[model samples]
Target: MLRVENLSKNWKEFRLKEVSFKVGSGEYFIILGPSGAGKTLLLETIAGIFKPDLGRIFLEGRDITNEPPERRGIAYIPQNYGLFMHMTAYENIAFGLKLRKFQREKIREEVEKIAGILEISDLLGRNVKKLSGGEQQRVAIARALAVKPKILLLDEPFSNLDPNLKGRLMREMKNWRKELEFTAIHVTHSFEESIVLGDRVGILINGEMKQVGEIREVFSKPENEDVAKFLGHENILEGVADGRSLNINGIRIELPQKACGKIRIVIPPESILISKNPLVTSARNNFRAIIHGIEELGAIIKLKLSIGENLLSAYLTKASFVDMNLSEGEEVFISFKATSIHIFE
Candidate 1:
């Protein structure tokens, strides 16, 4: 297990403030945040590249906050793959073992084994500078695994790859983790990647660690308005609470049982339903509104609705838009179940 408690670091422009989290053995934890949120800095700190001004780091159960990078037993792969340009793929992967003064035979054997697992055996003889982005990334991963570190930290490993290649490499990484049983902490801004690759996720914003939990829980029930907006909750309705209910722009919205106080309701654009007229359905919280605008976003249409001085965004299929004859300046009714409304105090 890897534990970080009150990890704080300061740079010229940004500071990481009392950040803390835990990753269990063999667990895949993703550190998610926007660009320049100090995600990479935290990873580097945990890997012993930067000493934290405050806080402790523990691997398994041993405190290693003051340890050198070499003694930390952690492998960090940076965004650029950070392989030696002058070395061949094989040599690059074997560098860690060679640095430890391992026997030539053992180094070669370990390098080949990891290369095969990462499906880069054929590229082993190629110079690192000549390999493609994906191949170089694989070589970097292979090099990290060659050391057999206690934990692996990947910093935006897929940001440079194309979408298709990113998907394939992500799948390969999952398989490699299962085969090696190595605990990993991956950092990325892509929600799709976080959902697909992470066993759990930690959200960081403005250098502050906001929330950490299982993927589903974090997405469905964020801890605050900032986290909700960061997780793609584009339609946020601010309202006052009045005993198990909220009043937003004259619309009474039932809360989720114990909800109270001034709350921000996060309704995902995809969770909203639209109709030309208020239909009698099982859904709760139906309201009539006007179509403020229509945005054609490829295969999907984004409808902007004017609901009592507030604007709500909803995504709909192009087919549904055409069938409903949705147009700007037209009257419509939007309905969303109370369960779909995520409230944060």
Candidate 2:
């Protein structure tokens, strides 16, 4: 396990504010935040590229706060892949082992093994600068794995790829993780990446660690409105809470817990189930809404609903939507369980 305690760094205008989190062995943890939120700085600190002004770093119960980057047993892959432009892929992969004074035959064997695993064996002889973006990524990963590091740190490594390629690489990352069984702390501003690759995620904003939890938990129930908005949460409604109900735009929504005074509620679009007819389920909230807008988003359809004075968004799979024949200006029944509601003051 890797543990970071009260890690803080002051770099110019940005600083990491007592950020702390832990990653279990072989667990993929993601640091999620927007641009300039100190995501890269945090990764660098953990990798020992930049020493934290305050904090302790422990890997498998061993304190390594003052260790140098080479001795930290951590591999960092920057956004640019950081491959030497003049060197071949094989040479890049062999650089670290050479520093460790591995025998020539041993380095070649280790390089070949990792390249085969990353499926870049065919490109090992080519110069890294000549390889495609995805190919370079593979080489970078192969080089990192060749060293057999205890932890891997990735810094927005997919930001430069197109959507389709980015998606393929994300899947490949899962496969690589399974085959290599390496611990990773991947930092990215993309929530989709976090959803696809992260076992747990920490939300960082304005150089502060806002929240950390399982993907579903953090995304569904954000710590505050800032985190909620950052996660692209829709249907954020402010209402008056009295007892076990909330009054929003004169619409009463049943609450699972008793609370009084002003409160904010977030209804995840996925949590709201839409049907042509009213659902006979145990959901506590149901509304007859008119579909004001329908957006075809490849595999998912986003429906803009008008429920009296409230405007809500709900997502449905393309197949289910096609089966229902939902369209703009059509009336549909939307139901969500009271427990699905995330209420905060």
Candidate 3:
């Protein structure tokens, strides 16, 4: 297992504020955050490129906070793939082993084994600078694995590839992880990647570790409005609580718990229920609104609604959207269970 306790660092205008988290043995942990949230810096700290001003780092119960990158038993793949421009793919893949002073036969066998797994064996002789983005990524990962490091670090590995190629490489990475059974801490700003590739994920914003847990839980139930908005929750509204209920722009919603005064409300787009015709139901909060706009995505449709002076967003399946025959000017009723409406103090 890898553990970081109260890690802190300061660099110019950005600083990591007492950040801490852990990855279990053979677990895939994704550090999900936006650009400049210090994702790359955190990874560098783990790889021992930068020493933390505070706290400790432990790998398998051994403290390695002061170890150099070469002695940390961690393989880091940077965002740009960081392949040497002058070297061949094979040489890049074997560089770590050469530095470790491995025998020539051992190095060749290790390089070939990883290359075969990444399916870049044919490109091993090609100049790394001339290889395509996806090819370079494979070569970089192969090089990282050649050292058989205890932990693998990937920094936005797919950001440079086209969408289709990015998707294919993600699936291939999963296959490689399963085959190699290596512990990994992959960092990316993309939530879809976190859900698909991570066993668990941690949210970092402004260099602060806001929340960490199972990937689905962290996404569905964010800890606050900041995390909610960052996770793409379309509705993060300020409201006032009155013990039993919360009111926002004259829309009163029953609360799951009792509290008073200001609060932040988070309701995901999918949590909202919309219908062309009203029906009697047990749901607590319902409102009448006019469709302000409509956006058609592939599988889902986004509808913007004007609820009094406040605007709200909701999503509907394309089939259901077609069935409703919704239009911009159409009036509809939207409701959600009080349980789905989250209020944070």
Candidate 4:
């Protein structure tokens, strides 16, 4: 288990302000943030590579705020893999064990076991510089695991990987985590990665942690406008709330709950239904809008619609697009359930 309390770190142009969160024993916690969000800085601070300006970090119940990086008993796998190019894969992996003064036989046993687990046994004798990116990554991971660390800090582990490789590695990592039963804190900007690897996620923006919760909870209902926007909510509307009623740019909507004064509204693209003709369905909010743009998103079709003065996004399958004969500038009816809309202050 790991806990950070009001952790603040300032280094050069980067600052992590009041970052606080917890990772339970054997839990896979993902720190989600965009580029330049100080995710790596925060990880380094937690790893004791960078000392914090204020607050404390605890592993289980022991405070490690003042501990050195080597004394923290944590393994860190940075973005570049950090392998010695001149050394063979086996040597690179065995480096950590050597630092801990393990016997040659013991080190060889551990390194070989990890290499087999990572499926990099063939590359053990090969120089690291000759290895592919994925192989190098596996070598790095094997090195990190060589020491039998109590906690692992992964900084953008799969960022450089392609989609298919990323998926495979994520599955492999998940299985390894379960089998190894080690606590992990993975930092990434990819939503798919967070969804796949995280038991819970902390959304960081501009060095501030806006929301920390279970993946489904944070994805389905974000905590604020910024969080919603970061989560890919395209339709952000400003409205005046009157009890359970909301008026957005003259279009009145009925909400499932009541809140007063100014508020923000977020309607997910999937929640809005698009039809060629008006439906007699029970959806409370319906508007006739023109398609402003049509984007091809692999198997999905994303349509930008203009409703009154606001623009909303709708998504459907490519098959649906062909079935409906939809095109830009075409008029369609957009309907969304009142319950589908999320309102935040």
Deviating ranges (above 4 Å) for candidate 4: none
Give lDDT tens digits, candidate 1, residues 126-162. Answer: 9999999999999999999999999999999999999
lDDT of 4: 0.91
Model 1, poorest ten-residue lDDT window? 254-263
Candidate 3 on 209-276: residue-level lDDT in tens?
Answer: 99999998999899877788898897887789999798888888787788799998887789889998
**Local accuracy of candidate 4 as per-residue lDDT tens digits, 129-159:** 9988898999998898888888999999998
Q: Against the true structure, candidate 3 has what lDDT?
A: 0.91
TM per candidate:
0.95, 0.91, 0.95, 0.95
How much lDDT does candidate 2 score? Answer: 0.93
**Which sections of candidate 2 miss by over 4 Å?**
275-281, 318-332
What's the CA error at residue 18 for candidate 3, in Å? 1.0
Each prediction's Cα lDDT score? 0.90, 0.93, 0.91, 0.91
Instruction: Kindly give the stretch of ten consecutive residues in candidate 4 with the minimal lDDT sum.
Output: 174-183
lDDT (Cα, 0-100) at 3 in candidate 1: 96
